[model samples]
Target: MKRFLLFIVFAAFVSPALVSAGESGAEILKARCASCHDLKGPAPATIRQLWKRDAPDLFYAGNKFRREWLVAWLQKPVRIRPAGVNYLRTINSTPTHQEKTKKGRKYDVLWGAVLKPLKHVTLSKQDAGAVADALMDLKPHTALVAGVTLDTSKKVSLDAGEVIFDKVYGCTSCHQIEPGYGGYTGAELYTAGKRLQPAFMLSYIKRPKNWDPKIWMPNLHVSPDDLQKITNYLILLSKEDFSESN
Candidate 1:
């Protein structure tokens, strides 16, 4: 009884601290992100401007980003999206629209080009760490997924998704989806659905090279069924209740 009481007391105290920490993350995001984002308006114009960029649909931040990745992102952002030169007939090695549209290149040329390290174009180490816990709590009001699985329900087969993820589309060559693939040219997708929406994934895949054609990742062929299967696989990879924890 005494131990339980102490535990309850600790929980009571810690919960408030956790609340305060969450508030701090909101503040930090405001100070760092508000100028560039508004969550409601004309959407962003450039991925760089935050105000201009339409990359992150932060309305789903809690749903999409992992606590650890979000924190690290604030400190040393890793570019999740590769370059963008698809629509434009831009010249060689010329910065793609995606690259041009983002807000940090000035920071890059001025602050990051020095190649200090941890090259994601947004946030410093200290700030990044602070944002993690807060961001995790920013969950959407939606209820649940009934626990996506690899072996149980027969809606989609994990092996099928794996086939599409690695073989048919050639996704493994650029993006790292699992421990097996060795590609590092693009952002890692090992936990994509955990951090991104299925619709968003579909759109991006449908138009892979559009944002940055010149970017190293080549837009490859993908079928609608394959896309759905892959999306299912991504969701499976992202969830926590599954038996096959990678």
Candidate 2:
């Protein structure tokens, strides 16, 4: 009986400390997330510098991601960019033994670290909320996101959007429209509308080079008309419940 009472007393003291640790979002991020991601940034200035990047910069995450998306992603981490953050590090020239595609094309394949499953630090639901709060606190690029707004006046059907992405811009070569439906270099487009702020999307797509000078995403030289349509399409696409279909 005396041992049981002592054990209960220890648990009472330790449990509160554990809860406090879970609530320390800023501390958690500094300790855990600071290693790979750039919490502070002036994005890569040269191609060499870009290739050296180990992970995405989170300095502008507040201007980039939706809070709910951030929370959920933290709790159950998944690979958003298929070729990984630094594709230059992940890609390898096609091996001689590898079979060619039906079109007889032999393209480069992803190798090295990305070949393994995502290596992000997963968090408990409570900790995820705390970490997300800390991430949202980082908004260094307010000027970049300023005055940018989604052009809701434009409307494009899903079929029309696909044509623009696949045929017009050739975006399907990198980004996926549905699960496993496109190349493995870029992020999945299906959830972008929900995950990203429309303003950030518009700005980033307008000139990815401006956001990250050495990023593999090129300046598509997209016309304003097409830009509005593309942003509209992304918003429409985000409305679809991909989880249900997948």
Candidate 3:
């Protein structure tokens, strides 16, 4: 009878601790990621608000990211944007001496914090899986991605895709297709295939204002056929081995 009483006492003491230890993924995200990313949102209303943001919003993460990619990325976090989330904070407006040689053409260059290596929160494999699960649940923009259909039938070679991206759309002026290869004002395009969902990419490319009201990326009004080709090309490009070049 005394042993039975002792057993009940031990169970009462340990139950609370076990419950605390097994925290839900949502709780973990609220504790760790809520500070830097916007877990709850109506995206920034204006450019001023956009510039004020310190990190990317996570409220639409489910619609934007691939689950497997999110799981891996959370474990080994890296910078997706070369110029940081707010490029204005990292850019230097002063014209360099090299600009003098270019017929007095002034250019904004990335300096200060952006030139340094990216600093981000890293997670353990188990914690990363939990966080990814929580992020995947935040699909507020289902309507935006609904109409986007990735068509793989439009077969495009890498060379043809580069022509459309660079020569046709002039995307190379702001975004890089490879490391250190293109201009620096925008996010690197090389990793877009693996980092973002196909539907998000197509929808965003079709209309930038729908996703981000004040984003600088303009709506290029890409045709439906071209959009499919471009998306397919991005997916194909992600499979390439750029390690040797780097």
CA lDDT, every model vs. true structure: 0.53, 0.85, 0.84
Q: Could you tell which candidate, 1 or 3, scores higher by lDDT?
A: 3
List residue ranges in candidate 3 displaced over 4 A. Answer: 1-22, 95-106
**Highest lDDT against the true fold, candidate:** 2
Per-residue CA lDDT of model 3 for 35-129, tens digit only, reads 98899998999877998898888999999988889889877777767888888888877755223435766766677787776777777677678
Q: Write the per-residue lDDT of candidate 1 for residues 1-246, one digit (tens) a residue.
A: 999999999999889545544456667766656554443333334545432343444554554455665765566554443322121211133344223435665211112222233343365555566665555565552332223222323246567777778777777775766643545446667668766655556545655444333334455666766666777787776563432533
Q: Supply candidate 3's per-residue lDDT for 120.
A: 78
What local lDDT score does residue 80 receive in model 1, on the 0 to 100 scale?
49
lDDT of 2 by residue, 10-127 (tens): 9998996576554588888888888988888888898788777888899788888998999999988888888898887777886764547999988677788886779888888888
- For each candidate, give its TM-score against the true structure: 0.44, 0.86, 0.86
- Candidate with more favorable, higher lDDT: 2 or 3: 2
